[model samples]
Target: MNTAEVLVESLEREGVECVFGIPGEETEALLFALRDSEVTFVPTRHEQGAAFMADVHGRLTGTAGVCLSTLGPGATNLLTGVADANLDKAPLVAITGQGGLERLHKESHQALDVVDMFEPVTKWNAQISDPDIVHESVRKAFKVAEYEKPGATHVELPEDVASEECDVRPLDRRERVRRPDPDEPSIDAVRELLADADRPICIAGNGAVRTDASAALRALASDYDLPVAATYMGKGAVSDADDHSLLTLDSGDHEEASDAIQSADLVVTVGYDIAEHDPADWNPSGETTIVHLDSDPAEVYEHYNPDVEVVADIAAAVRELNACCADLDAEFETDWYDDVRDHIVADVTPEINAGDPFTHRGVVTVLRDAMADDDVLVSDVGTHKMVIAQNFRTFEPNTCIVSNGLASMGISVPGGLAADLAVDSNVVAATGDGGFMMNAAEIETATRLDCGYTILLFRDDEYRLIADEQTDHRGEHFGTEFSNPDFQTFAESFGIEAYRPDGWDELRDDLEAAVESDEMAVVEVVLG
Candidate 1:
């Protein structure tokens, strides 16, 4: 068997169902091998779109989503989405074809040092210089990428090495990697702390939801009368409909949830990562006692010194905490949490007087009503992102994906494609005009794949998020406005059905029709 065959075999053994990328000369051998294997290769319109597809796939599935690209420009194009996956804590394996081993000593065309460029953005990375090491490298890439605090990992295979005749076999993934259990002392300390504290609250982060700690989180909250506030990426860590839920706390200053966190005597952060939401934003005083539970220790931040850390598998840690705090006789007060949650609900409540113009909130409200509990919504980075985060309440974990870590735009379309492919759930790629244009070409890719999903494009004809920021700070804005192509025409040009909803009423019907159609469709809603 050749090295490329062995590499593909390794990916299959790793349970990679599909690989996304653009075809190139350097990846010729690998492409042919993948074509012959059970692992399907999804050719995307652009390398960035391919990476975003893999990113969303990773977020949906606990396994690493794989993306491939050739050297230099191709590799560079994949950087943004790969970095987004890394910061968003999505498990992803990024494979890139590099120049031949013989040309390493000299500067070659389309051969920038791909490994060096990927170092900062990846959890681990390596170039398989030797053909024999391909299996080992591939195995390590998947393992590292899917490990706790899951992020992106890279593997580079040179063209010459890939085509080489190597007698090698893929590694066997016989056992699961289990996280260490939380120390008994730490759990004991957390129990004692929870018992002593009068006003305690839980801040659930992305890790909590992604690690399947939501059930345990709900139990902990339900049992202790603890209020659970999710970070943006951690939406639905606890059901927003639950009385214990405090939807989001990312809007720090002047937000009721922020005030709730400040007023709490003890703040229990479950699987919270400092990257998505800064402790300084919510805990300005730095005096609130923190108890963190996760697979890793809390980050050493000025405002995030944890008094007790239950470092273990998030679900296991939370379950242990629940079991530990099961018999607490302490009486805690949740009147403040009730007030904050009520305010949050009121703030996000739609201001729609029937038949009004479709604003961001209106579109989100209608879409939410149309989707099932487990259906997915991939939110692009824009002003609509703020609207969705504030107003849209996900009933289940990982149902609402927002790239808040790297927070890259242009992810929605491609991400929705992956979401559709990875799960048996209806998907909606919600994007503003600005973000939709960035990867609009991928609509064709989605069409080719027959990905039956809805594209909810909010048209404002500018970089609305940035414009809003400018408007808030200053009276005027510059370089934030732009013109949009006829969105319906653009979407239809890709051979997909497009709907330019006339008003709020039409939008609701259009969204339901698009999703129910089970065909590639775009529903354009004009936003102010």
Candidate 2:
């Protein structure tokens, strides 16, 4: 058997169902092998879109999502999405084809140090120099990518190596890695702290969502009558409909949530990552006693000193904490937080008007109403992301997918495709005009695959997020505006249905139609 075949077999053993990428000459051998393998190869218009699809697939599934690319420019194009997966803590495996071994030592067409190029953005990376090492390399890539604090990993297979004949078999699939339980001492310390605190709250982060600890987290908070706030990516860690939900923290913009955090004497951060929200924003003085609960140890920061760290499986840790707290009759003074919850509910409740152009909140409200509670909503990076993070209510974990860590634009479109492939529910991909144009070509890919999802384009014709920031900081906006083609025409050109809502009622009807339809469609909502 050829090395490429062995690699494909290894992936199949790892339970990889589909791979997203654009094939090139260097990847001929691998492509041919995939053709005969059980794994499906989803060809995308661009490598970036393919990587984004892989990223969302990983985010939705605990397994590593795979993306393939050829040498040089193809490899480089996958960098942004791969970096997104790394920072966003999604399990992703990026496979790149390289030039023949002979030419790799010197200058050659489409040849560069791809392994080195991907080093900065991946958890681990290596070049497959020998055919015998193909199975081991592929196994290791998947293993490392799907491990705790999951992120991106890379494997480069040279043309010659892929074509070489090898007598090798994939390694036996090992048992699932078990997470260690939180230490008894650490759990006791946290229980003691929570029992003594006057006002304690829990800040849920991306880690909590990724670990599927939402139910356990909610139980802990509800049991102790504690309020819970989520970060942008951490949205839906607790159902926004919950009485204790403080909605989301968009860099401390929500005054009520910030006040609650400031008033709290002790903070219990569950699966929190500093990258999503800075500690200094809430605990500027570095004086709030923090109980850090996550799979990994806390990252030291001036404002994030943990009084006790339960570094273990987040779900298990939360369950243990709840059990211990229940025994101690732990109850928090949460009457003061009722005002914060009321303010959050009022802030997110949308208002409707029969206006020429719809406001972001109005559109979001209509869209949210149309979608099922379990449906996925992918938010592309822009001003609309901020609006959705603030206004959109998610009832379940991973129902709202926002690229808060990498914060990349143009992810929602391709990410929607992945979301559809990952789950049984419908998907709604929302993006601003500027961000939509970044990966609009993926509409063709979605159509070709018969993937049914709704794309909501917030037509603002500008980089409104940056423009707003410019206006806020300098009192002027520049270099942020641009024009666009008719979105309906653009979408229809790709053989997808399109809609342009004239008013609020029309938008609500269009969204419902799009969701009920079995074909890919785009709804252009003019945002004021």
lDDT tens digits, residues 1-528, model 1? Answer: 889999999988988888999988999999999999999999999999999999998998888889999999999999999999999999999999988999977988897999999999999999998888988898889888888889999999899999999987999975557788888899889888877888988899998988899988998888878898888988999998999988888432247887888889998888899987889878887877999888888889889998888888889888887787766765679787787887788777666766677788777888988888998999999988987886798789999999899999999999999999888989999998889889999999888888899999998888977877788899778899888889888888988999998877777788899887789998988875
Per-candidate TM equals: 0.98, 0.98
Q: Candidate 1, 448: how far from true, in Å?
A: 0.9
lDDT of 2 at 138: 92
Error of 1 at 16 (Å): 1.4
Q: Per-residue CA lDDT of candidate 2, range 219-306, in tens?
A: 8878888888898888888998899888887422466776689899888888899998888888888888999999998998998999
lDDT scores in order: 0.88, 0.89
**For candidate 1, what is the lDDT?**
0.88
Give stretches of model 2 more than 4 Å off. Answer: 251-253
Going through the candidates in order, what is the number of backbone clashes in each? 0, 0
